[model samples]
Target: MITGSDFYHVMTAMVPLYVAMFLAYGSVKWWKIFTPDQCSGINRFVALFAVPLLSFHFISTNDPYAMNFHFIAADTLQKIIILVALAFWSNLTRRGSLDWTITLFSLSTLPNTLVMGIPLLKGMYGDASGTLMVQIVVLQCIIWYTLMLFMFEYRGAKLLISENRGGDMVMNNGHEGGGAGEKAAAAADGKAKIMPPTSVMTRLILIMVWRKLIRNPNTYSSLIGLIWSLVSFRWHVTMPAIIAKSISILSDAGLGMAMFSLGLFMALQPRIIACGKSTAAFAMGVRFFVGPAVMAAASIVVGLRGTLLHIAIVQAALPQGIVPFVFAKEYNVHPDILSTGVIFGMLIALPFTLVYYILLGL
Candidate 1:
């Protein structure tokens, strides 16, 4: 059970982040220290530099050989369940969309594991639970984040193709309807110029997504870190102090910078609930209820029981992750909703997580 001292430790971990966020918020909303462009630039820096290093640092330092396969399996299973459901909804339903698939996936599956999970779960479930949390972080950075980036790139490419096709149709229609013979000839030419096959177009989009993923630092940072972890563990090699210090300098600032970016985003918005009430409420439902419910089912399916199962469910109920919010703002995809998720998710996470802890302990 979480004691008063445990809660204090959780507070110690969280308070600094809130301080960074509020300082950024005050700078933007009250003092007007940064212009909109500057805020974007700061967020871009966090996305490109701080976050990648943070991912690398966490991944490289972990003892990959010591991973708990059962816990990892449970985590992977939960994400797969959500992904399959979202895929079906996107393909079959009129109300479903690619945008929501990406956003909802981030909202439901990706909790603030780095900032919130380690300290809180450690306090509740002992130091061993911290290892489980780190394993989740490594998996998240290496696989799921990369997949998220691919989805974003694919969606962007499809939108561009759609717009270009629309423009071409407009241009073709601009040609006046001339004589009957001329019109007949034009229609014949149009019919003869067939579009590429679906498979070919899909291959092209996949190629595009691959190229973008290659360029993304987050992609390689995690990969390189994983490779390093493997090499170091096998050979008993240690990273040099100088190199470690260089990485730690920036990576140590990562969570704080991310929170600052979130505050800047919130300050620039017209209100705290920037995505409005209904959307914010829906996001909360997914983050708290839907995410944990799915995770519980997955844990049971994967044969987790007792404290391990409880830890899995409680971690899922932590909060919305800040990294996804940063990506959303950088990609210009539903930033408002993500921002709301991060901001308000943090505000309510403590109580909600405690409630889960209590219920699961019972």
Candidate 2:
């Protein structure tokens, strides 16, 4: 069991991180040092450079084969279950758009597995405890992130194509912008019904989504990490020392940069909260309670034992991911709702995780 000193030690470690967030808030709200655009740029830097390098360094340095497939399967299954349930809920209420659905789903499914997970796990179970969390990060970056990106882009393409088709129909319907004589002539032509270019639209939408996915830096990072892991395992080729050091320097700053950038985002966010009270509460509940509970159950079924199981469950209770919220803002999908949800979720999950560790007697 953890002594009183251990309890204080864990809580103290969290203080600095939370303080960094408030520092960003103060920088924006009081000092006016950073404009909203500059905050967004900081977030971009973290996602494109810092976070990717962090992922690459962790993944490339580890043995991919040592990963437990059962744990991976359990994690994926939990996410899929949540996604399907949310899809049904959205359909039933008619209140869920694709934008909010993906955001809410991600908020429910993806945890704060990077900045928070690494230090928190290390504190509780020693440095080696974070290995499992790194695998989770890799899976999230590649598999989960890719699926969501494709869906959002693909759905957006369909909507744009549909809107364009509607405009074409209006044009062909003799709504002449020219003089009355042109309008009369156009109407008198008795134009045949123009069928929608359905097949062409399908093909075009696919292409558009493909292009977006390929362009995503996170996609490349995950792929490179995965390939590096495989190659390193099979051929015993380590990254050159110079290259590793370069990545290490940037990646080591990722956690601090991410926290400060989130504060900047919070200050610059819109005045109104788009997420409803009930929705925000539901997200927090799932994040702090339901998600961990489900993951715990899955881990048990798959016989995940000891520190591995503990880390998996605790990681589930981490707040929503910063990378996902960044993506939401970038896509103009559901930033307003996501912003509210993430803020509240983080506040609740952080303290709750502390208590959970004590109960576990770690």
Candidate 3:
């Protein structure tokens, strides 16, 4: 059971973030301090600068050599299960699409492990559980988040290619036809002439995605941090104070800025539940219920038992990660849903997580 001290610790870690969020919210909704353009700029800075540095700081500082393979395997398997399910849904179902897949994947698999999981799980499970949580955070920063970025870029590239191809078809048809019948014939011919083979188009999209991923700072931040971790751990070297301090300056603000950005997003929207009540409720269901259930199955499959298994499921029940919302807003893909997820997810995470803790403890 979580004691009063544990609750205090969690609140200490969380309350300041809420304070930052409400400040930003009041600035926009009540004070009218920041313009729409200014909010965009603030979000851009958080995404490009603070988030990358924060990722690097977490990745580089962790003791990479002390990995728990069982826990890591459980985490990896759960994500793989979610991915395969998403793939099936997208390929075989009429209701599925790339956008929903991306958003749902984020909603179901990624939790606010960095902000909420560490402190809260540490309170519930003990100090050893905190180490496990950090390992999860490091893996998230290195592998899963990078994969999410690639998917976002891939979807963007695919859409851009389709739009360009459609534009070319229109131009070709317009130039070659003088009447309705002729235009229909010309359009069919133009589509045949302009549209590349599916395999070829897929290759082109992959290339474009790679280029965009390369340009993204988050991509390099994780890679460089991992490389630094390997070298530092093997050689017993430490980052110099100046360099460390510089990173800490921005990295320290990452979660706060992310929350502030979330507040700004909420204030600008028509309502706090930006995606409507039904969708927000569905999102909460995925965040709290579906995530933990899937994680429980994955943990059992990976042979996790007792406290570790409980920790796995409970951590999965944590709030929606704020970073994914940042990515959604930046990429313009279902930002409303994501923003709603983060805002309401945080609000209800405590009671839901408490229930999980009591049940798992039983």
Winner by lDDT: 1
Q: How far out, in Å, is residue 290 in model 2? A: 2.5
Model 3 residue 75 lDDT score: 92
Sort by TM-score, top down from the best: 1, 3, 2
Candidate 2, residue 185: how far the Cα is off, in Å: 22
lDDT of each: 0.82, 0.72, 0.81
- For candidate 2, give the lDDT of residue 209: 59
lDDT of 1 by residue, 1-362 (tens): 55788667666766777789889999999999999999999989998989789878878878899898988999999999999999999999998999999999999999999767886787777788887998999899878987888788778657755654522332343332122223221333454423333554455556656766788888888889999999999899999999999999999998788778878977887777889999999999999999999999999998999989999999999889987886797788898999899889987888898889877766
Model 3 RMSD in angstroms? 5.6
Backbone clashes under 3 angstroms, per model: 0, 0, 0
TM-score result, candidate 3: 0.84
lDDT string for model 3 (1-362, tens) is 65677667666656777788789999999999999999999989997998788778877877789888999999999999999999999989999999999999999999988777876887777778878887898888767877887788778757855665533433333333222223222345455524433554455445545665687787788889888988999899989999999999999888788779878877887777889999999999988999899999999998999999999999999999987887898889999999889888877888898889878876
For model 3, what is the C-alpha lDDT against the true structure? Answer: 0.81
Query: Could you tell which candidate, 1 or 3, scores higher by lDDT?
Result: 1
Residue range 1-362, candidate 2, lDDT tens digits: 87877666666656677888889988998999988788878878986887777777777766798987877877887788778877887778878677667876777778888777877777777766677778888888877887777777666655754554432433333233222223222332355333334554354445555676787776777789889899989988878889888888988887777777777777776542457777777667767788888788878877888767777787788888876776787788877667766676666666788777766665
lDDT (Cα) of model 1: 0.82
**Residue 225, model 1: Cα distance from true site in angstroms:** 0.8
Clashes of 1: 0
Point out where model 1 deviates above 4 Å: 156-193, 326-333
